[model samples]
Target chain A: MNKYWHVVGVGIQNTLVYRVNFLFRACFALIPLMATIYLWRAIFASNADSPQIAGYSLATMTSYYLLATIVDALTAVAEDDWQIAADIKDGRISQFLLKPIDYLAYRLCLFGAGRIIYAAVAALPATLFIVVQRSHFLLPSDGLTLVLFLASTVLTALLQFLMSYTIALLAFWVLEVSTFIFILFAFEYIAGGHLFPLDILPSALANALSYTPFPYQLYFPVSIYLGRIAGDELWRGLLIQSFWVATLFGLARFAWHRGIRRYAAVGG
Target chain B: MNASSHSRAFAGWGLLRRYARLYGALWRNSVVREMGFKTNFVLWIFVEMLWFALQIAFIAVIYQHTDRIATWSKWQVVMLIGASHFIQQVFTAVFLLNCSNLSELVRTGRLDFLLLLPINTRFLVSFRQVDLGAFVNAASAVAVMIYAARQLDLEPGIVQVLAFLALCVAGVLIHYFLMFLLATICFWTVRAQGIVWGYYNLFTVARLPDGAFRPGVFKTVFTLALPMLLVSNVPVKLLVGMLESPLEIALLLGMACVCFVISEAGWRASVRQYTSAGS
Candidate 1:
């Protein structure tokens, strides 16, 4: 337990040491926000119809984007896949294997600690941006909704870590994982609601995506905060997210174990 | 004096030949390296194809909701996206990876070996790797542009196509110079990826119609200062026959030239200040 705490401490300290760089990165994240805003505003202004599209008013739609971005920053998982893949490729995993520490716990704890700092630096400015654009923004007032949103955000991180780690474990089989990472990120960008509100997607497409885990990361949480999903639907969404975390956790473990066996076979 | 000038001209031609050969060799080496990971190569192509498809889907979705994104027809926007892909891929293949790698070189002391080379360091660094996958993606983007033009009932004259191609090259140069400027900051920051990424996202707005962005001062900043908005917009507009101002072409050319000069000067200054991994 103490060792895990120490790892988390190390992560926090490292984030602090590189806080300036992280702060700059947070600022950079705003560029995409600006682009999305510009793109959507164009869509709305030239709408030539009602100010609403697919049941979304311009203000509510813009608010969705703003809140979605904040959720994205909160749930953004640092890519540890590169480090993991390198460790596998170069026999660096042996050090971790020799330790008594649980690898996932160590990785997740360290990652979570760092992101706590990252979310701090990013979320504040994002919230202020929302406040400045308050006319177009909406905030959930109910305590229950905010708690659910927070819970979902943390689970989203866990699920993302597992997803990335599972993909990284493919290094045990593949010669390289760079393409996998790129494709996964691209897929996430669309399905995860980074590009636009998932609610804006075609109803059939939205219904189909409900079965997938991608929306929970950014879409579901943002939706919850906007009170878009309410009552029983919110709890069901939470249930679905938790379901993904459990499933992904299992997949990550299986990959790690299989990867370890193959790695050992090669080492011998 | 006449004989000396002739010899100097010959030396310049010889230098060009040597660098050209060097670039060919670097590309060959890169292709060979990628061949070892054939699956990854194909995957990169597929991944890029998906991204392009999504961009199209995004455009389609918006058009379904409303017509004309700031005076851009759906087909015209598709053509613009295709031009954007071509420019971006060519930039990535030729300069993006190269300049992005600069910070790594600076950190690892490997840049010492590059600097100690007998030829120009910028030339070597700028053409270090050739991404074949990006080249394939670029060809696909050209196909998209041709298809979009056909759908729009537009048959570009040979001269217009030539002009478009030239402007595409200019756009690519602008992109390269801008990226080079960002990467050169590594000499002081030691970590310029954030700056590079920040610039990249800002640059992304260039692919969109200019009318979509905030007008007045903010737009002018991107138009002149960073010049991000002009990179793909000018060439696409020119090709689509939507460009009205001859002055816009002049502006783009001037921007490209100024960016090249500033980037080159900045790179040299950064090199001068570099303490190097040894220091």
Candidate 2:
């Protein structure tokens, strides 16, 4: 446990060293939000006869996107996969195997520490953007919604990390995993409601996506906070999200075990 | 013509031919490298195609509700997005990797070798490698643009096609200049990857209809300051026969020229400030 604490400390220090990079990334990540605002404003204005499009007023729609931005800032896996791939490729995992440390737990600590700093650094700019557009921002409907939103957000972070870790485990088999990572990222960007509200999608398509884990990543939590889900639906979404998280965790463990059987410390 | 003037003209032509030959060699080398990683190439094409498909899906969803986004029809907006993709893909194929690598070169002091070369440093650094995979996506974008043209019931003449190609070249130049300028920030920072990617993110505005940006601070800044909105808007407007005035043409050309001059000057200044890693 103490060793894991040290790992968390090291992660915090490492991230602080690149504080400027994170600041630039956090601020620039808002550029897409600006484009979205202009785009939705145009859409709503053009269809003035229809006050709501797909069951969302302009204000509520903007609020959905704004909440999605914050949710992403809090939960998205930035580049942990690439780092893990490098570790596997360079044989740095040998150090962990030799020690009492579990590599996955070690990584989870680092991820938690990194996310803490990232969320802290990102909160300033994200809060400022929300405040500037406060007229369009919506507060959580109630205390239970806020609590559930937080819980789901935690699950989102875990699911994202587990999925990324599993993908990086491919480094054991393939020389380069960038293409695989990028392909998944492209799907995540579209299906995760990062681009738009999943509800705005056709009911058939949205229902199809609901079965996938992607929407559970960004859309489910934001929707919970917006009070768009309740009672049985909310519980079902959380159950599905947790199911994905648990399944990905098992998959990650299986990959690690199989990969370790074939691991050669040749690079090291 | 005087002998001195004629001699100078001959010397300039010789230099131009030399640079053209050098560029040809670089392209050949890049092609060989890309061929060495054939699977990566194919998968990158797949990745880009998927992204393009999703973007089209987003547009389709919006069009289901409203016939027009602002004053532009559905096909017209598709044309604009397709044109934007084409410009971005072409720029990616030619210059994106080069600009992205500039930071690493600076950080490792590898740029010293390029500085000692006889060729112009900027040209050599900016055009060293080409990603042939991106051209596949560019071709897909052209297919979409043609499909959009068909949907709009317009058959562009040869001159119009030539004009469209000319404007695309200008758009690519603008992208290159802006990215190169951002890349040059590596002289001050250890790595300017985030800032350069920020520029990439900001360029997404190019896909949105120019008319969608109501006249205000956002429109003015993106237009006159960043010049992102003009990169794809003007070319598509010309192709769709919606170009409002000659002023639109002037603005894009003027923006391209201004970016070139500023980036050129900025690169020179940054090179002067660059200190080797050892120093």
Candidate 3:
């Protein structure tokens, strides 16, 4: 546990050294957010007579997207699989295997370091967006909403970390994981509500997604923050998020242990 | 004079045959390479199918809240998605890998070897490798397009089909040029990965209908600066309706000409820079 702190320190140093790359990547968050804002603004403007569609007004939807972008920045992990794949492919994982430090914990610290950097880098753009669109911005209506939101968001970050780690473990068997990574990213954006609010989705699909881990990644936590998931739904969303985190953690551990058996297959 | 005309026609035919042979061998090599990892290929195809399904689901979700996004109806949007998949998957299959690798080649000085060959560097760099999995997705996109057309209860006539095909070809060209432009930027910068990735971030908008976004600066940029809107939107519009306006034709042609000219010019400039730098 104490040794992992050093890993985090190393990751922070590395992140700073590559700050330009990270900031360039973080700026990408603004592009999609603007696109969605313009999209919703159009949809709302064209149907100005309707006060609300699916219980969200233009202002609330805009605010929802703005908040969601920040949450995305906080939740997004570093590109973990490229290094994992390279390590597995080049026999470098063997070096880590001989150490007392666990690979998963090291990755978690690195992910933490990335999250911190991303949050700091993303703050400038997010603040600018908030300032320009401050009129449309909405805050948590009450203290409970804010608390529940924070809890669920932390759970979401953990769940996302586990998910990525599990996916990275697949590199143990394959020569390349780029295709799978592409597929994972596409699904994550759609299902995780990074692209749009899940509530705006069809009730049937939204209800179905409620049972899955995807919505908990971005939408549910943001909804909790926006006070959209009130009372029973808030509690249910939190429970479901915790459930996903636990399951993903276990799954990632299982995958790593199972993946190690193939280390010899890398050909001694 | 008759003999000269015949020989000229034969020379043209011979050039065509040479290109066809080149394409055939490149594709065969790719197919054989993927065959070695048949399971990975199949897995990728499966995952792509799943991604396509998820996109369709997203559209269904959007339509549930409203009848139409703008002028485009639900099935029309689905067609846009299908067309987007078709253009992107086919582009990925045919052009993506080679274009993406251009920057890497520049970095490692490997591009020098290709420049040494008696071939067009653009030609060699543009269509070298194929992702057969993406080829499978392109085929599936046709099925999806047909299904969406059925849902819309519209049978495209020959005119509409021809227009759709032409617009799609134009879309592919624009996409290739944009990517090539990104790749060419590597000549100036040591690390151009961010720009390449930024292009991808911008591309997410291309898959959506033009009507989904409003008449704003962002839309203006997508329309004028990038013209990503023309990639999938115009083709779907043509299939659902017809190319009803002359303006649409001009926009498509303008986008095609602009992107093609700019990317080609940039590539030549980059090559000149590379040679002068003595790389």
**Candidate order by decreasing DockQ:** 2, 1, 3
Best by lDDT: 2
Candidate 1 positional error at B251, Å: 1.2
TM-score of 2: 0.98
In model 2, what is the error at residue A50, expressed in angstroms? 1.7
Where does candidate 2 stray beyond 4 Å? Answer: none
For every candidate, what share of the true interface contacts is present?
Answer: 0.73, 0.76, 0.47
- DockQ pick, better of 1 and 3: 1
Interface root mean square deviation per prediction: 1.7, 1.1, 2.4
lDDT for each residue of candidate 1 in B127-193, tens digit (9 for 90 to 100): 8988888999999999999999999998889999999999999989998998899899898988887
Tell me the TM-score of each prediction against the true structure: 0.94, 0.98, 0.91
Q: Name the weakest run of 10 consecutive residues (lDDT summed) in model 3 chain B.
A: B270-279
The best candidate by TM-score is 2
> Whose DockQ is greatest here?
2
